[model samples]
Target: MSDVVLGVDIGTSSSKGVLVDPAGKVLASETREHHVDRPHPGWVEMDGGIWWEEFAAISRALVHDGDNVTAVGVSGMGPCVLLTDDGGEPLRPAILYGVDTRATAEIAELTRRFGGDEAILDRCGSALSTQAVGPKLAWVDGHEPDAMAKARRLFMPSSWLVYRLTGSYVLDHHSASQCTPLYDTDARQWYEPWAGDIAPHLDLPPLVWPTDIAGNVTAEAADETGLPEGIPVIAGTIDAWSEAVSVDAQNPGDLMLMYGTTMFLVHTVEQRVSTANLWGTNGAFEGTRSLAGGMATSGGITGWLKELFGSADYPELLLEAGQSGPGAQGLLMLPYFAGERTPIADPDARGVVAGLTLSHGRGDIYRAALEATALGVRHNIESMEAAGGSIERIVAVGGGTQGDLWTQIVSDITGREQLVPSKTIGASYGAAYLAGRAADASCAADAPTGSSVPYAASGPGVDIATWNPPSHTVTPNPGLRQDYDELYDLYRQLYPNTQAVQHTLARRQHRLSNATDTRSTA
Candidate 1:
């Protein structure tokens, strides 16, 4: 049997695992779907136990009793805050990434305390937004003192898996960078003063590169997962960075566009580019930097539309959407159902469907939803470019990339061609590659030092370009560009045009929801 590596990723809506050989052929794959828990508005969370449970299940289902799986790799949806006790019991449900907007007050308080948005951005490479882990930590300290008292350690999904599997507490530098104010992007270490202020009692893990060998799976973990007793495990980064690795879009000017429950954009830059509009942080590998932008909703709007339409499936919707043509037949949507993240970090922002008419059909609405996501992508790209991001190429990945209509709309709106890779297996595949690279290096006695890549089949090391290359390019239609440009202008204006109304309704929604919950309890 060929040596293989098992890669598992704990995602937002599911956990996915893939077994791959040294040559990157996927041997087996498994998925277990799950969802986040929202007990209150602006609060999205998941039981931390679910992450480990899913990982163990996926491992057992993928690796056989006697399979020669040389290594294990892990990735997850993060910069999450999972506060655990000394013995590793979760104190509370893991506060998820940016979508969980419960930290708004904490964000403002910290921003003011840290000398302002520019100061924090200059030091931490990201502003104190919902995305920054520091604000979330402060929120916990202020709100959940009972949990905070018992919180002896902190862990994200990947780090949590690494701790469970190898008994080694470590977090990748890339993921650490996302813990803004808690980590110094230049120093690549925990920023002591701010970390002390935010999570004083928590024992932070050692920082390692995503490709570094975290440790070997212990005998206890082996018993649970049915893998080799001492197989190596590579430290993994966040899902988006791993997705970038999967497509070999880590070089400067390479912008990775991830479309899923949420839309994420990672633009790798040559030098550090800090901006309040976008997230600036260290890359997956050393000496690399990225300006990242995330939307709280993308496919989320389309999914909601599908559920509302009830009769039409994705394929049918895609067909009708394509037929509806550019500009969505005089329909426009804001795709801010969950609130906006990058560029405009407003949690009160609500979804807006403009240009609605009795004449418009479901197909036109669906097409408008698709176009809304595309326009958001354009907005993020524009923000990135304005902040000194050189986006020369866009590589599209994720579940949204499975269908062509979405990508086509994005290209048509942005007037930029997008390259889709052969194997868009995403974060899990990237984790597997890192696992393979680590296993190869461990096997070789003469591996070189320095860069993450070593023992490459060609070039310097295990490059993703060798494993997966662009299968096709989605080119923009020149004719649609003029129409899209007009709509894009309106899309940008619609938010500020109706910001006060959105916020007013958002506040009323909170009051109504609270009353409903109180009555339900009574």
Candidate 2:
């Protein structure tokens, strides 16, 4: 039997699993679609139980009889707060990353307690915001007493899967660094004082590099999922970092743009580059650092617009949007339907569509949505450079890269060519690569007795370039430089100009939602 590694990633809307041979050939891929539970505005969550269930089902589906699954790799959306009781059962639905804006009050409280945003940023690499795991822990302590009382373990989606598959409570350093005040980026260890302050009762998991062997599949888990018992499991990381690894974009000056439910930008840096708005953290492997940013929406806005357009599918809309041309027929939209993150961490920032006229059709609106995300990407890229990071190459991944329209607009708007890899199965594919590395017998043989080997060891000798090289490039349309420059300027000004009104309307939305809930109970 040929040795095959399994990779799975838990995402916002679905779980995807892929099987890959050591030669980088994808044998099979499986997807399980699921939805996040949004019980209240600004709150996004999911039952941790769903993660394990989806992972197990995907594993079973991918691993048939006679398949020699050598190793397992996992990744997921993160910096999430999934607390469990001492016995390892989840206490409540996990509080998701930056999109869940319910932690505003807790963010403010923790910032004050920790001296201020700058102090925390200097030490933690990222400040308190909806993205930080510390504030969410504080939120739980205040709001859900029952869950808090029993909360004794912390797990992100990837870490939770590791625990389920191997009975090892471990989190990747990349994910742990995003935990903000709970971890010190320079020390590469938990900041006990801050962690104790925020999560007094919770016992944090030990950290490992994403490639390190966490543990082998336990007999119990293998029995339930049919994976071979004792196969190694790599300590995987947050999905974006894995996505970076998948395309070999972790080199310094390489920037990865992920277009999915939310837009994510990750830039590899030689050393730590902390920005008040962007996340600065360790990379999946050691000796590399990353400055990361995310927009609350991207394909999300496009998908929502598609549902509104009713009969038109993405292909038809793209054709019409292409005809709408460079300016979106005088329409411009802020891609903050779920609220904005990075460069401007405004949870109350609402999406704004300017220059909308009665004559504007769905195509024009769709074009504006695409342009808005492109502009947002440009905004984050500028912020990254401003923070002392450099970008030499831009790589585009995720489902949005399937069409040239969106990637073209982004390049024309940003004036940077984007390299699209041959296989954009994304984080799952990257996870499999790491798993293949872990499964290399020489990796274990090369390690010192009772000590782990560094990820840079050439024993595995795996190179991602051979697996998913850049198959094509989207070059910028220099003809649109002047037009996009003017548009980008207007985009930068729109948020500040409408800040007051946006906050007022956002508050009114909260009030109306509260009233609706009250009436339902009445």
Candidate 3:
């Protein structure tokens, strides 16, 4: 049987698994789709059980023929606050990535109790925000005491899956750094200094390098995944980090721009650079760091607009958007349907569409949505560069990259050439690469004691087959750039100017909708 490596990615909408050889070649891949349940307007939750079921299905599908699988690596949406009981059963659906802002009060309280923003950033490299796990944990403890009390351990999305497979509770340093007020990045260990007062009696998991071996897969997990028992299970990381690895983004100045349900941008940093606007953390690769920024809505905003406008699927919509020229022909949109992250940590931010005229058509509106998203990407890239992180190269990944118009718009907006991976499976391929490395190491170690072992290693950098510059680089037109620059200034001003009014209106709308549903049910 040929040696195989399995990579599993647990994302917001679905879980995908891939099988690959040692040379970074993908053999087969499978994806299982699921929905995110939004009980409250701002609250987002997904059943952890569903993730595991999908994972099992994907694993079985990939390893059905009993290939010689040596190792496995997992990655998923990050900084999640997953509450599991003593026996490792999820008490409630896991709270998703930093995009979910139900913990706004917790963030403010943390800042108040801890000296201030600087103090937290000094310790964790990231200021208090609703995105960090510490704040979310505080929210659970305060609001869901029953679930909190039953919680024996907390894991990020990836950590939860590893614990399920190998019964080891651990998280990578990159992911753990996001647990502000709890983890000490300098020490590379959990800081119990505030763990007690923050959440009394809460036990933090051990932090490890993303590639460190957590444990061997248990017999039960092996049976489900169709792999041999006792295979080493590597401690994985957040999806963004894994995507970076997949594209050989190991060095500083290499940026990983992911376009999934949302857009996530992370760039490696040589030193810890603090930015009051962006997020900074230790890198997935040992001894490095990262500056991260994200937008609340990217592909999600596009999808919502698709349904609202009654447009065809994404491909067809892209075709129509191509008909519209630059500037969206006098239509400007703010892609903040969910909220805004990165530059403005305003959860109250809402979407806006200005410059709409009777002359505008559906194509113009569609073009505006794409341009709005691309402009948001540009905003983040500039913020990252200003904060001491360079972006010499950017590797784009995700379903959104399929839209040439979207990619061109992002390049023209940011004025940086974008590289798209030949194999679009960013995170899954990265997970497989990590696994293949482990397999090689295992083979080397078993060969001899104290003697050098011979075994081929995984590919050094990103497979070029998965990456190439676009045929035509979209150079920023001076006229369009100047116009968008002025419009973007206005776009940034909209959030603070309208935050209060937007929040009030959102609350009233929420109440009214609830009352109407209650009346109808009665």
- Report the number of the highest-lDDT candidate: 2
- Screening candidate 2 with a backbone cut-off below 3 angstroms (N, C-alpha, C), the clashing residue pairs are none
Q: Flag regions of model 1 displaced more than 4 Å.
A: 442-461, 519-522
- Encode model 2's per-residue lDDT on 1-522: one tens digit a residue: 877999999999899999998878899999999989877778899999999999999999999987899888999999899999988988899999999999899999899999998999999999988899998999999998889989999999899999999899988889999998999999999999999988888889988889888888889999878899988888899999999989889899999999899999999999999989899999888878999999998988998999998999999999999999998999989988888988799999999999998999999999999999999999999999999999999999999999899999999999999999999889999999888887676565233211343566454336788888888999998999999999999999999999999999989988888898899999
Over 4 Å off, model 2 = 444-453, 459-461
Clashes of 2: 0
User: RMSD of candidate 1 to the true fold?
Assistant: 2.2
lDDT of 3 at 61: 86
TM-score of 1: 0.96
Per-residue lDDT tens digits of candidate 1, residues 364-403? 9999988999999999999999999899999999999997
Q: List the residue pairs that clash in candidate 1.
A: none
List per-prediction Cα lDDT, in the order shown.
0.88, 0.90, 0.78
**Residue 384 error for model 3, in Å?**
1.6
- After superposing candidate 3 on the true structure, give the runs of residues whose Cα lies further than 4 Å from its correct spot: 442-479, 510-522
Estimate TM-scores for all models. 0.96, 0.97, 0.92
Where is the poorest 10-residue window by lDDT in model 1? 442-451
Query: Which pairs of residues collide in candidate 3?
Result: 421-466, 422-466, 422-467
Q: Is candidate 1 or candidate 3 better by lDDT?
A: 1
